[model samples]
Target chain A: MFTAFRDHIEKNFPQLLSKPGIVACSGGVDSVVLAHLCTQTGMQISLAHCNFRLRGSDSEEDELFVKKLAEQLDIPQFITHFDTNEYAAAHKLSIQMAARELRYQWFAELMDKEELSWVLTAHHLDDSLETFLINLSRGTGIEGLSGIPPDSNGIIRPLLAFSRAEILQYAREQGIKWREDSSNEETKYLRNKIRHELVPVLKELHPTFLENFRKTQVFLSESAQILSDYTAQLKENLFVPYHQGYKISISSLQELDPLRGYLYELFKEYGFHSWNVMEALLTAMSGKEIHSKTHRLI
Target chain B: MFTAFRDHIEKNFPQLLSKPGIVACSGGVDSVVLAHLCTQTGMQISLAHCNFRLRGSDSEEDELFVKKLAEQLDIPQFITHFDTNEYAAAHKLSIQMAARELRYQWFAELMDKEELSWVLTAHHLDDSLETFLINLSRGTGIEGLSGIPPDSNGIIRPLLAFSRAEILQYAREQGIKWREDSSNEETKYLRNKIRHELVPVLKELHPTFLENFRKTQVFLSESAQILSDYTAQLKENLFVPYHQGYKISISSLQELDPLRGYLYELFKEYGFHSWNVMEALLTAMSGKEIHSKTHRLI
Candidate 1:
């Protein structure tokens, strides 16, 4: 299984194996397994842990856990604390958004200081499936179905090929200790509802559901790429820069078979998502126009 | 509600409103409500019921129910009996497939002989949601995510704008009678499982789940259309006629960012679905080939 993981990384992302990088380990089973795998594969890797301090002592415990694991493995570790609630209130962002912004911003600085080639996060198959479901439940387009990408710039997901069950099994076998985030059961969170309720039932319905989900993710991602190319050509043919934004030819758009979707895609980059209002604009009076803060469709 | 139904047809499906068409009634609340709405709108619609005789006396009762309803409305009616089991065995198809083939074949003939311009079916929002779930559970691509199309050829679905709950409420208000199909409870089937088990929980999670699903479906369908146009252009650029089959340049294919999906979409017309083996062929020995019964890729 480890060899297969190595082979997948080598084939799809060879650069990660050839150089030193930072492993964003939270001392969870997923990240711990990823770090262990990287060490076993003879990759020069160090651990980075983020303590948002949102979970009180639990946050401090997680930071300490990753520190001990790194020390035990004879590897270097870096830790950071984030004032999540303060940042969220100051920036008018959600707690999740604040934490994500602070964490990634810190990871960037760590990369430059450590001279690491990339950052590896333990985003596994389950995480990807949950993200796919979250987007689906929230009404996403072609691009949303792609799930979590395996490689994005210098950030890579090494454990993406493995499932949560596989990671738990591996951790138990290796006697790995980690902190469990109790917030995982909070149904108020959209991701938790999908992960705890929707995904399990879907998996129980079939023996190979996860494998099939992965394949479907791959298909949607590919279809999205093909659509991007097509939509780019359409934008070029039908849209032009105007006063403060752009003008889209209504006549050309009306000629489309499914005009709503084409119009949606054309104006999507400009922040228009409501299909009903956009659809009505197509047949509105000649002078009718729809406007978002960023762009306008006439 | 009936006025809204009429308005929907007038706005989006004006052809159906202007001419006569066959209403494919199943003697259910859905079709009964649809027929009543058509009459209220002052359109010419005749009910055509397909009695597959799979449900013995129950099937005959449904046929009688539809005939009586047509008589009550003072409209013409058509009924046909099909030997579904024999058809399935003879054609090496499932009973459902056999019934579908038999029903559609008869519909075409009915249309031409009766001089009807189109066929209308009461496939409501709930049915569309179930189909979406069925496709998702079975691991579908963008095309599958599109759900049921609103109009295909001369077939129009006016009732699609309404959900089953709305239709049921309408039926109660109008005191409309309908035959209940007992086979609906047989959860042994996949579609039934999705409708009964999955859809309810999803709806319960949010007040607007179905609405969101519709938006997602429309976006995906549009995306699928754009992708088809793009792939057609790509095939023109990257493929050439060679010997017994077409030749695709492996190098050009390799240049694609998401190669696995592009390759799947390329070979999909040839009935190739597996990507693992097909992906390996990209870097396999130059002479290596992946062959289906109808097509080959070298």
Candidate 2:
């Protein structure tokens, strides 16, 4: 597994090891494995852990576990305690969303301050599948259905290549001791519920659900790209940039084959998410005073 | 209304008036109004109606109604009767889908034989809005949610600028008599349900829900265009086209800011939809085979 990990890094992200970076270590099995891989590769790595203080002693213990591991590896460790509950309340965000924003924002800040090249996380394939389902259930377009990215901004997921099972297997083989958060088993989080229940049921219905879904993602991504390319060409023909958004020539738009996907692509630029809105805009192209708080297309 | 219709055509599709066209007159108020509008403008027009024969005698009545109206207007009329049930069974299509395909296919044939430039329909703003909601409910992506286009292929919707209520008002003002399809009132069909129930309920929730939805479509269309444009530029930078799909240079992609919407847009070109799949892909870039039946991106 380690050899596979080494080969993967060398092949896919050869420049990654040359940069100083921070691993978002939670002392969980996945992160521990990731940290171990980084250490084994002799990469310049710093461990960063967020102590959300959600589970009192358990949260602190997790922080301590990561700190101790970093000490044993003789790598510097950075830990931050967050008042997540208060943050969630103040921001009116779900705990998960708030925590995510807080953690990533803090990680980004640390990266900037320390001049770290990237931030690595341990998000894996199963997590990607779960997110795909969640977004699907919530009524997403092709982009939303695509799932999590490999690298966003300066954040990289080195362990994203592995499944939870694979990570656990590797951890066991390496005799790597890690902490498990009981919250993972709690169904209160939509992701956990999806991981524990929905996915298994879906897998039973179609044994290759995950594989097929991942495949579909790849296909849709490609299809989207083709459509995107077409839209780019259309934009050159149809649009002129405006102050807030864009000014589309209604006559030019009318001239284009309606089935050409460019019209829908045009709608997404203004933060509209539904087909009805597009219809309204098409209708309004004639004459109507359609207004929204933030934007108005007509 | 007739003047507005003519003005729209003259402005948007001046070439359309130079050629003969067929109006898909359904004998419903909207289509009746459209037919009258065309005749009033003294444009070369042929009236066409499809009798799906689903409503037995009522279906025949509609055909007769359209024939008499066309005769009254002293215009060429084309009428066809379809055994929709048989067609549905043979083609493995739902009755509604079968009827749509049959009607369009017949229209295309009529256009070709008659040397018609386009097939005109009476799809209005209300219909467009209903389509938008239906797609939204189905969790459609940006493209699907963009609603009905004013012109598709050789089909043009001239009355899309008007609402159903406006169409009825215009018909009444013009003293136009038309047959009503009872199926439209039936809640069994998803479109009817949306038209009668869902839209009203949504309107109640937000007085401008319909308007806002329409605006959202416009916004999303534009946003989708921008993202797609960026994706196209990024694709050229990171991928080389292959026969099957495209080969992505992992290093070039990794060098890009992943949070830039273009990353997801680039992945979407390949067919990934869920955020998780993108995350998984990012992880896979670190060296795991993200496999599907037809393709694998490692």
Please provide TM-scores computed only on chain A for all of the candidate models, following their numbering. Answer: 0.87, 0.86
Candidate 2's TM-score reads: 0.52
Q: How do all models score by TM-score? A: 0.90, 0.52
For residues B1-298, write the lDDT of model 2, one tens digit per residue.
7778889889876767888899898899988888898888878898999999898788889999999999999999999989999999999999989999999999988888878899898888778777764554443455554567667898998777667877898889878898887777662466766665545544543445455555444444544555556566667767788877777765565554333234556665556544644565578647766654455675
Candidate with best DockQ: 1
Candidate 2 regions with alpha-carbon error over 4 angstroms: A187-189, A204-212, A229-233, A242-245, A254-264, A267-270, A274-298, B1-298
Query: What is candidate 1's fraction of native contacts?
Result: 0.51
Tell me the TM-score that candidate 1 gets on chain A alone: 0.87
Error of 1 at A266 (Å): 3.2
Per-prediction fnat: 0.51, 0.01
lDDT of 1 by residue, B129-204 (tens): 7777666677888888787888887778887778888899999998888888766765237666666666776776
Q: lDDT (0-100) at residue A68 of candidate 1? A: 93
Q: Candidate 2, residue B59: CA error in Å?
A: 32
